[model samples]
Target: MSELRRFLEQLTAAPSAEALWDLHCSKMAEYGFDRIIYGFSHYMSETSMGDPEDFILLTNHDPSYMELFIGNGLYRDAPMVRWALHNVGACSWRFLWDEMARGALTEREKQIIAINQRHNVTAGYSISFKAITSRSKGAIALTAREGMTQAEADEIWAEHGSDIVLMNNVAHLKIVTLPHQSTGRSLTKRQREALEWVGDGKTTQDIAMLMGLTSATVEKHLRLARESLSVETTAQAVLKAAFQNQMFIVDGIQG
Candidate 1:
């Protein structure tokens, strides 16, 4: 079978966000994109991309670069990031140079450019996935390995850009289907079970009977689940857990 066929099969069957990301990074590396950063947000607004804790972030970029770019919120002013927010296709890094030539880059954007230059993140492509909802956005940046010039990167893209975009779109689709566990947002097994039952329309008494616990104990579990999910009610917890793909998931079955 062809390499792309094998990759598609593996990606379709990938059971977790981390495993899917690992497979995608390896495949992109074969095409000379050695470093990648992907971000998605379901809580995006007109002015913000929602809470940082709610974002699904994956990357293989340098730790220091990520600390300033993502951690310090430099991505808000990044030229490619702005492009990704508005467009739904692949873009070459040459666009940044054109913007610079036209004196279009702002001071903060210049600072971000300097950071990328210092880190040798000079040549690359950005792909913005088609948004499925009004408040949803997803994008990925593929950085060429150090020493590869923009011209060479563009050459490779001219040949295999379609395949790369297709693979990334598939990967992004599969990623959202898999579970996303963010910090301070993970529920325990019992907590998840309670939420799942609530999602299935079970009452406190019904869950207590099903789990062989007292009604008070079941209530405690539900309360804790709401806290873990940072919601005020069990109904909201169920919806949030389902959104994160954490409700009713079979943990080891996918492994």
Candidate 2:
């Protein structure tokens, strides 16, 4: 077996969230990628559930891209952001060029892509995951400079897909280990219903009609779901709820 495969097997056997994060970082290093960032938007704040924002950020990029990413709000317009919004499982940096060619690029997004190109960041891949309870919707991004081939990308994806899933699962396990005072309360029935609907790919209007409630009421429930889960968006809320088994799976369609 490859070293990365062995690491993943060990991670699967591990009993702790920290151990999983450690294994993930080690595997990313083995892949020859210059940077790996795993971010959970829902768990960015409110650590009642054991700090879900705890991340493993590995990078050899010049500090300049880091500065621009944070200082200039490039993250808001990043192609990764768009991918997350659309719930894409995996994507390449080349998609950014395709988006630009299609005239779908915003000025800020174009600028960030340009900066990355100038910095020799030839390509990257991002994988998003459903959030665990007390956590946020999450994504793991691996970036590399020139010479990263499609075969290499496919190898990383096949090798590390389970690791990404386990990362969020272990994070939730950590929350379950926390004291009652540290962990937040469970979801309400209405919140659960809304989450199930969202996980089924039902829009707010669709859910409202199904439940005999106004769309605004459905929106309110979703908003509460997001706040209670410490997630910033509805999609994150659905992801987290599904991870916790508080929401049911229907049609195999995730929110």
Overall lDDT per candidate, in order of appearance: 0.89, 0.61
lDDT of 2 by residue, 41-113 (tens): 4344342312423222333446787667644656656877668655736666567768889999888778877
RMSD per model, one decimal: 1.8, 12.1
C-alpha lDDT of candidate 2 relative to the true structure: 0.61
> lDDT, candidate 2, residue 41?
43
Q: For residues 57-136, could you state the per-residue lDDT of candidate 1 as single tens digits?
A: 89999899999988899998899999999999999999999999999999988889999999999999999999988999
Q: Which one is best on TM-score?
A: 1
Model 1 TM-score?
Answer: 0.92
Q: What is the lDDT of residue 92 in candidate 1?
A: 98
Q: Model 1: how large is the Cα RMSD against the reference?
A: 1.8
Report the error of model 1 at residue 223, Å: 2.7
User: TM-scores for all candidates?
Assistant: 0.92, 0.50
- lDDT at residue 226 of model 2 (Cα atoms): 83
